[model samples]
Target: MTSATLGPLLAEARADGRALGAFNVITLEHAQAVAAGAARAGVPAVLQLSQNAVAHHGGELAPLAAALTALAHAAPVPLALHLDHLDDGPLGRRLLREAPEAGFGSVMFDGSALPAEENVAATAAAVAFGREHGLAVEAELGRIGGKPGDAHTPGVRTDPGEAAEFVAATGVAALAVAVGSSHAMTVREAALDQPLIAELRAAVGVPLVLHGSSGVPDEELRAAVRSGMTKINVGTALNVALTGAVRQRLVDEPGLVDPRRYLADGRTAMTETVARLLAVLHGAAPAVPSARALPADGISPRPR
Candidate 1:
């Protein structure tokens, strides 16, 4: 399948009353498993590279960007590379200018930490750069409430009127609005404010994004899509899967010497995670895979 751009993928998913799933890639296994999972689900997905991911690989993105793009190109289903949650620092601005060439079809410029006016101006400049570069620019204003030693304010939420105003001022391709979900939640019980989501969707002209969505339950996710959310971002959930699988493999097979053995299981877990989430986004109940052997190629394998 060909690497795709956000415009067509968004249009296609919107037409089907489904939201696009964007999963973060922190490691090469994440990229490979996400691609294989999307292929198994037979849906397009965005393989996201976030600022934290850049730091994870080294303090630069070039090494990982090219490899992720190569994975997207080799994905069995249409996939796109996205730069997620990049700040407005020197490196951020430089990346904004170079992302298109780095094989990213979309980039999220996060000016959310800045004061209100500064956030607007920074986002507007990013929008301008994206406009000239033919890239889709995603913007986040304020914070989607969450906690991990209080990294983001736990109760702050996005106001619909403010969101509409920000959209008009910034010309962002999509907007991530804070409803009620918290980030990095291991439990699937975040109560989303459907009314607020509907209100924001009505006020904002662009597609609405639901970030920190791994904490959202299946029924809540379907309701969010029904209420007008168009893009769903999930991260910690996949990490949970990968880490758990790798840990279990090591425990169950103590003599396993090859790192590939545990890594393969981790990749398999993430592949299954991606496929299941795609099904949820498609408004279908997740199904258990039939008992069948998966191929052991470096690329994750799923029953076709």
Candidate 2:
């Protein structure tokens, strides 16, 4: 864990003019691949388990969370476990109240589906819960949209002045803003409003987050970081890589029925993609701290 929190790394990224790559973890393979990639890159990484992913595992969190905690402990570079896209109030609240014990260091209280005022209220409550529980919290203000399974409607942009006010009212650690990126994009074609990103960076005090980064091109993602985005969230890109590799592996060896063989290839593919993404986000500079800086038990600083 390297005594790293999302806040300090984000603040450091903002100060250093780089962006941290936050990858979503769906299974043990996903966790291993992400951690392996980050270690290979020698940079700090965020391994996030999303609400949808939790649901896929029968709504149980303990086993997965525990495994990810162990993986973080054993990872060569710093890694943080985060609960991502927690939108449903009941489920989100429950996870906020319970997940700290399961080793979640942070949570994203997504309220983009609600009306603006209602969203702010829900996010404020979540922020309060996070503060009480000693967890770093993030919330989305504007609706970042996409083709399918996305939370918000399209064409909704974040207002800089309102964003500043929202931060004041919610006290969130970071804000995910809509700057032309959409979720579930298969291709890297989303055109971002660099000027708007810059404006939001200037208006908001906390580090800015860019969700659905899998849709953005490497150059555009780099440009977004340059425009002041500190954390970049990517998911679909890794899924694409993993599934593609699995398909290719099966085709190459039709008689191979072993799950481990196929899944190992998928993990390798995902690892390669994650390493590339990290390089794009932060270049070759090492972002992880020395192992000596972290606790011997692999637990880092907790908010209080």
Each candidate structure's TM-score, on Cα atoms with residue i matched to residue i, is: 0.90, 0.90
RMSD of each: 5.3, 9.1
> Candidate 1, which ten residues in sequence have the lowest lDDT sum?
291-300
RMSD value for candidate 2: 9.1
Q: Write the per-residue lDDT of candidate 2 for residues 62-121, one digit (tens) a residue.
A: 888889888988888888889998985677667777777888878999887788889889
Question: Which whole-number lDDT from 0 to 100 does residue 173 have in model 2?
Answer: 96
Extract clashing residue pairs from model 2: none
Error of 1 at 162 (Å): 0.6
Error of model 1, residue 143, in angstroms: 0.8
